[model samples]
Target: MASIEKHGPSWRVIWRYQGQKQRTTWATLDVAEEAKAIVEGYRGNRTAEQVYIDMGVLTPEVPVPTTPTYREWAEKWLGSKTRISPGSRARYKQQFRDHIFPTFGDTPIGDITTIAVGTWVNDLRAVMGSPKTVTRYYSAMFAPMKAAADQGIIPVNPCKATDFKRDQRADDDTGEHKAVYFTPHQFEQLRAAFPERWRVLLDTLVETGVRWGEVTALAKMHLVAPTKRTAARVRVWRAWKRGEGGQRYLGTTKGRAKRSLPIGRDLYDALAALVDGQPDDTLIFRRADGRELDYSDMYNDVWMPSLIAARRCATHPPAPRGEQLAGATGRCRDYGGTRDSGEPCGARVRPGTTRCPSHYGPARNAVSMCGCDGVLVIDQPASWHDLRHTCAAWLFSDPRMTPLMISRRLGHATLATTSDIYGDLMPDLEESAVDAIADARKSAQGTRGKGARRKR
Candidate 1:
């Protein structure tokens, strides 16, 4: 039974059903009277669903929606990912902010359809202008939705039906999806360009094939020498990586696998000179003022300038117009016919030339033709990681080296990775396999011929 009562200028509806009391306040007596009638009707024998529908709590054709919005679910999912590395967490947060939130944040998890998701993916690809970037953003968006579906919050994952392909231009730019590396001659030229103090660091990078983070984290204690006559080897257990806010910390290597690499005598001697009497934990390489080396600072101040200097053309003739070269800035080295003058030419040289237009011949029409004076001009610039690729290339060039040996040296997680990356460089192995098969067939034929003759 239900009743309406006036309580301090407001009308209240009170009801008793299923042995429980329920009450609600209304501003007017008329509204409270209507609610009291509806509650009184519920006193009769009826299903809970019929009562709920009569009270406008649920529609006859639709059940109550319990699905959370995308934003709510994403927050819950991100909070549960506590085991991820700090860097990865930072990246996920960034991806959510930059890509996922703007589009699907307010949408209900159940309401997100496959067609809507496909449109969103296409929009991201169009706006981001890179398929690789779109792929990453798509993955970030998919993770939370997939989790929702797996937990039964949603019936299906919309992302599971969409297909995204990486941009072909990206693969073409990065050496046809293969690792880009330096040749030995190019490495030597780059080596000579660096200051003597930093040469050992470059040597270590080329010889050891360790990652940039691992090499930067090297300590004196990590080097081991079994005997005085033997070359030392580096034990790689940890690496230094930048986390959120550019904070640096030591962590395990990429594959989470520790490895040891043998160092040549030259490298060992160089390292010994640097850390002879220092503490076992002292860094093997640092700035001139004893500060930790930052990759960006070193690249901008030293690497690019050195590379430019090493590739400058020395024999370029002076311009026909006798105008100063367009990009000239650095110190010139061409002395012309004044070698006996006992002074360097010391004039400002152009960017693509070793000397000013007056000293060197004319600036060549093509940049490739400019650096013909025994200097190698690299068409594509190489990053620090490319040094490791160069090491892999050299190892693959040797017929004696096997994939397992290269995989261990490069610290790859599996032989398949090494084979997939450097498989194109192993063309000779295919030829050898074919020859072996042919030889086996020829030997079987010869044996058959001999047996027939003996029977005869």
Candidate 2:
């Protein structure tokens, strides 16, 4: 039955919605009419209605285990990831500590929302972390949450919906860095500044473009003569990793790369010539204490001093250049140097790329060639990494090699990556691209002018 209630002399109709059997109240005729319209619109029947219930739906709070702090989980993940080659594992550990743990470590995973994750990443970028660095941090931070989601411990991953927005280059940038190459002149000045052994280290690194750790890990055993099944080559199997546990084991190659490098004429001759009289298993580069030289000490004592010396040379050095250390040269050695190995150069370390240990470093006193006081001489400033950059640059700068090939030569994961960093080096070609398009446009305009004249 419908009833009319008096409200300030205006009649209000009260009615039931579902059916006589099902009791659902509507305050007025208009309310009943609107509710009937909705039910009809939804289910094609005005009678269909469910009682609105606002009771309880609890969000699953992901349990943060009390015994294991965020630090413990991070450490465990690092420890598990240590199966990878030592260098990569060390980087993972560094990323977790420096970026991941501090912000979200104590927070329970279930409570972390996508918006919060995005905000944290934005904060990290504001603090000046590189895109690459943040990318790694993103992976480490979310991996556990993802696992928790899969295990039904959490409803969703906080990091699941977020995309790292900073990968696009800064609007002012062209996504390329300028070239910071080591001049031949600077190389010479640098050579004379360090010990004969260090000179060899620097020179060989430039010529071969092998990493510092690779050089440090090089033992006489790894550079063995070839057998019947394979050609003569040097194995790049091991590297000394500096980490919490001290020197950790590294290297089995990342993907398709063979752990050994082919020792062709340059490498074969220099290594053979340099190590001719020495024993087979000797460490190629070692410290005074007979321990492997820590990478930092190697740079601080050897490479950096060489750079300082280069600055002192007569010719002022160009300020630091490009993406790579910009001086890692490589391939092999043979000529110049004038050593007793019976070869032409004998690995005496003249100034070109291929170099051996004995004549490796530059003169300690800065000559006019480098831009510094000629008075001081000891070690030069140069890290093996800078030398690696130099080596890749050497390949990229050549006319014959394409950027794609260079990427492969340098063991980069993708071609676009190599081009992104070094695209500016090939300025002529980039300019040519714009010119080519402009020329085509002009040619088309000429054709259109001819057509209009014909019409006239």
TM-scores, each model vs. reference: 0.65, 0.55
Candidate of highest TM-score: 1
What TM value does model 2 have? 0.55
Which candidate's lDDT is highest? Answer: 1
lDDT of 2 by residue, 189-275 (tens): 667767776776776677656766677878777776766777667776666555555555554444434455555555565566655
lDDT of each: 0.73, 0.57
In terms of lDDT, the poorest run of 10 residues in model 1 is 333-342
TM-score of 1: 0.65
Worst 10 residues of 2 by lDDT: 51-60
